[model samples]
Target: MLTLAETPPGAVVRVIEIMGGRGMRLRLMRMGLNLGDLVKVLSSGPLRGPVYLENLSTGVKLALGRGVASKVLVEPQ
Candidate 1:
């Protein structure tokens, strides 16, 4: 298991857990990122920038801040 922020670009992973408050979790869910969802890391920005991810099932892409990405736990798929 690894945090979303640690995943390399182009890596596919399944969301396991989100270690954040209700609002943060809800926000991610609204963006199609929920527990058990498969997503691909499109890009991880440099210098502590946002991370870009794409949902494999919905083809929805989202740009999340590094803080948020660090709270999302995932497993390699």
Candidate 2:
């Protein structure tokens, strides 16, 4: 198991769960980041910034701030 936020760039992870409110949770869900979904870390931020991720299912990419990304639990493959 590994935190999605902690995963290095170019790595892939499977979403486990999201810990947050409905608003924030819904936002990520709408972005195709649902549980069991696979995502690839495109790039991490500078020092402590946001992280870029590419959705394996939808082929969409998104940049999530570190704080938010940290809340997203995942399993590294």
Candidate 3:
């Protein structure tokens, strides 16, 4: 499983797992990211900044901090 933080811009990946605690899981869920969702990496922010992505399932775009993104496990799709 590759973390979302490791994924490069322009890649499409499937959410495989979220390696975080329950609170983190709830936060991500409210942000519209969930297991099995397809997401496209839009911009991998610079200098350990946030990662911007688009949820292919809902056409929603959001930004996630590097730490939070690293907890999201994904597979290239």
> Which digits, one per residue and each the tens of the lDDT, describe model 1 over residues 1-77?
89999999999999999999999999999988999989999999998999999999788999999999999999998
Model 1: how far residue 14 lies from native, Å: 0.2
Clashes of each: 0, 0, 0
**Model 3 CA lDDT for position 14:** 98
Residue-level lDDT of model 2, residues 13-77, one tens digit each, is 98988888899888998877788888999999888889999999789889899998989999887
Select the stronger candidate by lDDT from 1 and 3: 3
lDDT of each candidate versus the true structure? 0.94, 0.88, 0.95
Candidate 3: 10-residue stretch with minimal lDDT = 26-35
TM-score of each: 0.95, 0.91, 0.97
Query: What ranges in model 1 sit over 4 Å off?
Result: none
For residue 71, give model 1's deviation from the true position in Å.
Answer: 0.1
Instruction: Report residue 27 deviation for candidate 2 (angstroms).
Output: 0.9
Q: Arrange candidates by TM-score, highest first: which order?
A: 3, 1, 2
Error of 2 at 17 (Å): 0.6
Provide the lDDT at 45 for model 3.
88
lDDT, candidate 1, equals 0.94
Best by lDDT: 3
